[model samples]
Target: MLPVDAMITNQEKLNSLATECAFHRFSIAEIQAATRNFHNDLVIGKGGFGKVYKGRINGTRDTTRRIVAIKRLDSFSMQGAAEFMTEIEMLTKVRHSNLVSLIGYYFDDNEMILVYEYITNGTIEHHLRKADAPLSWMHRLKISIGAAEGLNYLHTGVGNQQGVVHRDVKSSNILLDENWVAKIADFGLSKFIDQQTSGVSTRLKGTFGYLDPEYYMTGRLTRKSDVYSFGVVLFELLTGRRAVDTSFREEEWNLAKWAEKCVKERRLDQIIDSHIKAQISPKCLKEFVQIATRCLKSCRKKRPTMAGVVLALQQSMALQEQYDSSPQSASFTHIVQHLFSGSRLNSVVSTSASAPVTPIPHRFSSPPVTPSPHRFSMSPKLDKIDPVHLTLNLVARATQNFSPSLKLGEGGFGTVYKAELPEGQLFAVKRAKKEHFEALRSEFRSEVKLLAKIDHRNLMKLLGSIDNGNEHLIITEYVPNGTLRGHLDGAHGSVLDFCQRLEICIDIAHGLTYLHIYAEKKIIHGDIKSSNILLTERFRAKVSDFGFARLGDAETDGAQVVNKVRGTLGYLDPEYMRTHQLTPKIDVYSFGVLLIEILTGRRPIQSKRSPDEKVTLRWAFGKYIEGDIMDLVDPQMKESLDIEIIEKIFELAFQCAAPTRADRPDMKVVGEQLWAIRMDYIRNGRRG
Candidate 1:
């Protein structure tokens, strides 16, 4: 017999081994009884590897239900004792927040039984398939971030041993927990590579849709190969479509090919899930397309690293913040006018009471307000009614009691309320707070005068305003969907598809263009951030909140004045903050920061592990430029994003966030590039 201590140590090792192998030492009779002799009713799910069954594990005094996904190793199958050993070793050492935990197992005679934690929320593939309960863009982003973070840990986690790579990383392999958090599963095809042999070649192993094409052709596996597979997952997440659909026959069976074709023909809209269409911002859609295209590129070297992918998603969220802070540009002004040109604005203005005249000297005889021809219809009599009274009662009834439920949201200015008219029209009523009544008065007058003169789709419309006693309210068309910040914070859904994110950036740029150039008085949006940009049901963006907006003039204070710094923390322009010099480029710099957020999925001020680690995106851009783009993306998004689009977005963000404002592209150029990219997808039949 052995010494007592040695004997105990050996027993402990045995127990550990048993746990790793999932061996419970269940008697044949007990298993059969629990499973009801493997009855069909007990069957839960089936996969290529094995069948799953729901059963009960019983003790002398109690019984508890347990779900076990059983994978029986055929005696004669190619995957024998060696593969089993490899799997046991891997599963034993790997544990993470987003990795499925292993449970007990059994081994007797020629049979082998393995158990795992039961994930009740089902598989990622299930959510992608369900039509009625579709996953929102925000949820998708969150999932992508979590999954990617887990994979990142696995790929470069701590150990004396080599890094491990999960050869299979499709949607089916991603399991969802109770809260819908994604946990990567199915590591049967995993391989461990010592850093010393980092460049070694191996046999290609993975499902077709998610396999890295380079690994298949060259037989060389690198971390970048995982990046390629992740791109496919991103495409699936964005489109809510499958990787491989046999129903499409020989030509359209391939998802990549089909998507590429659609992109080329500007018909990508046809390929996306209808449920996701209304929920995703056009900016996000454009970014998704760009990212997906890059991920599927023929060359693997051009792909973004997993870190880069994460950064891209974070960057998308940042862009929303920037948009909220900035004022509407000229292009947006044009679009808004065009959208309501035919009737709405004209009907309101033309039917209003005649303008009150003020005597002026002959030298200054010009009219105070010159209504555009597009502002009203040709009908002379229709313009006779007073427009002010037409909307006064509507505003009064909407703000009745100022019910809490109908209150839309609150901001620096005051609370907003949602009002419904007898005609079923919805409007957003922004009520000024008592403390800020004076500022509110100024803003109300400024907005009324300015909006009345300018028209654009990207600019928020001023439907009307009310100044009654101490209560002041500004009414505008109601946007059902909330602010961009809501979506970024995971309120709306997971990650915004890359394409849609890009489109949102472009939309903001267009609005900025209109304000900077097209408007009668060139104006500057003082603050640009996600919370201030509003979205519509169709995911179209409209720049809102112009209370801090100012016009450029010779008598204006110095561009770099010593004044209080006002704007969101992460998106503030470094130059503006330090020197207090404000310029149109200040908005550009903020937009650049937003671009970085879109690319990295990281906040501008994320804390690093060490006190010295730089968390700002500006400091982190170098890592991405060095081909570590994957490090920047939200881990939840790593599994499903396209590497190419990530890289492209990174490039754009880099340009936008350049240290010097002079190096950045103007909003018009940025808008044009985004529009061109969207058009490219449209022309290629990639977007429907």
Candidate 2:
């Protein structure tokens, strides 16, 4: 919201500031005549700032008239006044190719208007979702790169060694000209800081879904916030979705959160808009996702500088160019096969701004199926892999006595090593030193008992245990891909895809639900996070490491008790953390946090988040209230998401993470809900 600079209360001070700022001044009557006395027909756009009218003013000397956009502030908006002053101040001293150019200003006792050169083509947002024609991939890349360069200039190119952070960066703020060039506009929320000084802490203010979690939590508006917002715009270009789409469910209301899940889960193909997905090469897609993801990191220090972001995007653009002309690329017919649907080819995309753009169907919704809670699946057959005791020598022979080369990864409990058994079969051996036998023994006992009793497609299968009083080891069928944490941590070099991630989630829910009800005894998995969830080569999720698990009697709420609570901090149940009551509710709460992690691509405990913002659910809950939960979604998962289904998962996750334990749904119900979500997505062609 910005007003005309000349409309300040102190006329003398305004005049002085204008003289010092070096901007042209205009007469109030001249402006009134140009806009036809602010006629409604002349009005071109309306927003929070107020009405904007298209006008033609006489040139300084020539007979030719200049077409301009005149913006008038709403008297009720104090924010508009502040923005006007800042825009006047900033636009005068700083200049760049990618930013909108200010022409002159007019103000008097009852009238205030700022004139800017008219941008003929309108906003990037307009060409994106509102315009009749969809922007091609090259156009999308061009606009994004231009916007990034402009932002880079603002952050560092401003004279006097100052830093300018564009607090509100979105598609609508990026104006496009007749040539389709990008021009960043709206300096209302911009902040200027000295290069030598640290950032100033101020009140948090930004549009929903585009706001930085770190800035919103700490009130520290750094350059990284702009980078985060730019990253969101990049997502918009990639997904062909809005930053905050209300038509979507609450969880998907914010595109960033949903996209992050797609990137982390390696499901970019499933979420990207179909129109542009083919235009990008897989390599460029990876590079682009990497840069966007880096920019959206919760920690400011972790996010790349605008300059770095620009460089990375340039590299991605180069990669796209390589894809365009490469002989190895797919033939035109192959790519064209996916360009249009059977009947959409006949539809013409209109270009009239007054008329609404026909939206291409992104994803379709299916009838939701809610399964009965009474249904339960028993362990298929434990006889397939019974708990066997192998000698230490045999375990050592398979793993070469814990060779470093064969080591898969190390966890809190023990180190996992890949082993080739005598039968030439691959297996993962979890081992601990003799010194930590007591703790390892307890974990081993719990895992053996629970895993031995249960057998399900989604549950991790235990093969044999070796305990010769020295080096203890537990053997299980080897998974080549490693854990979900490994993929999330970027150690695997590739992420699980969207469909795979959802499938994994369904698999986990099935396993957890089985343990909660179908097992010989109802069990509570005290700890459920990404690391504990193993992944197969196909990215199938298998519930592993039941060290903190316990037998729970669902019949009696207080039947199970614990002297001390044991669980991950952010994933830990708040009520369970306080009451120390070991119940199925605790497992439900932990699973809820896991669901958030899966959806948001964030760690359970974000160390860099502000003190009060330690938990992802808390931040998510706040955005949920603000009605832009999609902001928490990943940037990679763009157009492919089913809006309604994403909201259901988020609602389910929130309910699972509810502060009140009694409000949490049972694991059986959780499993059914997750199944329903997957089925819904499948119906929407998620697998395709």
Candidate 3:
């Protein structure tokens, strides 16, 4: 039996915690106002305690709307005031980026509601089982890592040193943000631990199929229970199956048990989700499966600590990086060492299956392309209104009549200058020619209407437009950070870490998904490049400059657009450029170029190599086909890169730049693919 830390139940400790922390206590009216009076339409989640509603409140700098998710507890549920107070007490004392923030709470007249920062993507369970868009392997891994980080916080007494056990650590409790970053949520079942202790003895309570054997049978609850449940989550991610699925065969009903058997037999590929099969590196998968095996051991002592598990996961991801980086020799299996603590695969399985499966050689032997994924248009549309019109005089005062000092940049459209309003507010103002401005003027209202219809956090927010017959001016929120082009331009070309670039790519994909599938109108962003992609204060990627966007409907587009060719030289789609027919694939093709820029930190057009021909597209293509993808990657950034993920991104970029439109994935699949690629490092808690 594993050693146990005595559970402490000091009432004074609880009272002291309540007194020490300051929590937002909202009135009934405020709760109703935020949730539209607990409207069913706003419900985003349903748990045993009660329903969760998504609501917008007035907290923006200028009284604009800020969304928050509110969880209301049912008065009659077993998880009542005790659980509610426990959650608030625990959350108020601890804070980590990976842990969900309890912004505020309400407790008046027997009504209890807890408010948290809205996580846009919803829970891990939704993406794993319910949502049509199946999460790629990397995404699943990101969720695992994020959840582990949160768990480690509690186990290691991070911040307020409130060593706490979530008590209920499962996929449903893991929430994801717009960038696919994971957060641990729902602390209703949590229990506090002594700072120096390993764990505590408690009642046997947890989801089935994930319960620690010792905890359930002997009632000796330890932090290992959480590890056991996390192991189950790893099982689900690997198999794309549930913790307990009645539909599964008897021997495979419990995913942890079945996975244990499969890992020992080396039949991993056969059980992998077909959708993400090609994405997993064989060595990476083995290491990950081995970690899961350790976590799921029947003997509590055999399971690694959450901290150890976190390191193991990171090492697994690092192993994949190693394999992807060394391609010349093609010997991957021999290089991977049994690095994680407590080699658990050999011990977990009582007997290997009679028919042992073939030991998969390495990821290099796997097929190149991921299978077409299900669409991810389940994203909610953001809100917007007609531009906040500004007068010509106000623009002139802010820009000093287009002075060079305030100039932001110059481009094909016109010159952009930084401007300040009467209220000392900053804005980006663009200036253009009368003829070109007139074209914009004619399409201003309709285009603004379409643009206004687009509402996504990943897309640049349109402030307003101005066209007074003599001149044309447009205003937009000044993106504090410069364009992606500016960030990737330099000799070093490694300002952004691997994680930041991955998130930027995912952000661009999300913006494209919103425009093509979620927006009211299926709009085609004619120009998709690093210059048009803007970054925010937090390094969030926002697709900007819809000046070249093309609107489409069944009657007009016939699912495609036709127009005079217009786009950057190197980013143009060969098919669209040749056929003079516009389609969403144009954006996909350009996005492929953007991916290339991100991977290699090279401009679309490299005109000189000491006045001789430098690198050519044909040469790059040949390198990719010859299995030397590392050659195209920016050498400066290679040291910190995830070779497996970079290879996958390269493959996706190749698919996007396919000569035929059908060969290229739509923006929906593109977004999913990019997000998955970014998630590779996210799950391991390392970007660079």
Residue 608 local lDDT, model 3: 54
**Residue-pair clashes per candidate:** 134, 22, 1
Residue 528 accuracy (lDDT) in model 2: 83
Model 3 over residues 1-688: C-alpha lDDT tens digits?
Answer: 1112211232344445545764455667878998889999999999877999999875523477689999998763434766777888788878887899877776544566888899999988777788898998767776777778789778755444346878888888889999888899888888887643456777777788888887888887677788899988888877778888889779988888888888779788777888888878876786687778888989876676675566446545544555557332211122111211233322111111111233221111122222221111112232122233365655666777667778766555556688876666677877664445554453444445555667688887656666554556666667778788878874223387666777898889889988877777788887788878888888899987776677766465425645566666557665664466777778988898788788887765564542211323333444443335577887656455545466667766766765556546788888875765555456655653
Residue-level lDDT of model 1, residues 1-688, one tens digit each, is 3345544554465478766654454565665666687677877666555666666655323476565554444442345444544565677778898898765555443554555666777777888996348787767866876777677667756365467778788888887888888899877778887633434587777899788787888898876677777777877887777889887677777777778788889997887877667666565565556656666766777666554555555444333323334232211112223323453321101100012222211111232222211121112231222234324444546555466667666665667778776666566877777665774566556655665555677777766665655456666667888877666555777556656676777888889888777788777776666667888887778888776566655355214353555555556555555456666766776677766665555555544434222344544554553456567675644345545455656656655654445546677777765665565455555543
TM-score of 1: 0.47
Q: lDDT of all the models against the reference? A: 0.62, 0.71, 0.68
| Weakest lDDT window of 10 consecutive positions for candidate 1 | 346-355
- Model 1 regions lying over 4 Å from their true place: 1-34, 58-70, 74-80, 130-132, 195-199, 264-266, 317-688
Model 2 agreement with the true structure over 1-688: per-residue lDDT tens digits = 2245544453555577678865668898788889998999998787777898999998755668999988887663556556777777777767888999888786555555688889888887777787788898878877888899899789867867588988999988899888888999888778898654547798887788889999899888888889899989999989989988889878787889888988898898877878887788886777678778777888776676675566556546655765787443222122222222233322112121112233321111232222221111222343232233244545566777577778776655666789886667676888764555685577667776776677777877777665544445667667777778667656778765667777888888888888888888888878887877888777888888776788886678424767766765456665564457788888788888788778777776564677445556656644443335467776645556654466667777866765556546788888886886777677656668
- What lDDT score goes with residue 536 in model 3? 83
lDDT of 3: 0.68
Q: In candidate 3, residue 8 scores what lDDT?
A: 26
TM-score of 3: 0.46
What candidate 2 gets wrong by more than 4 Å, as runs, is: 1-10, 326-688
Q: Where in model 3 is the C-alpha error above 4 Å?
A: 1-22, 60-64, 159-162, 322-688
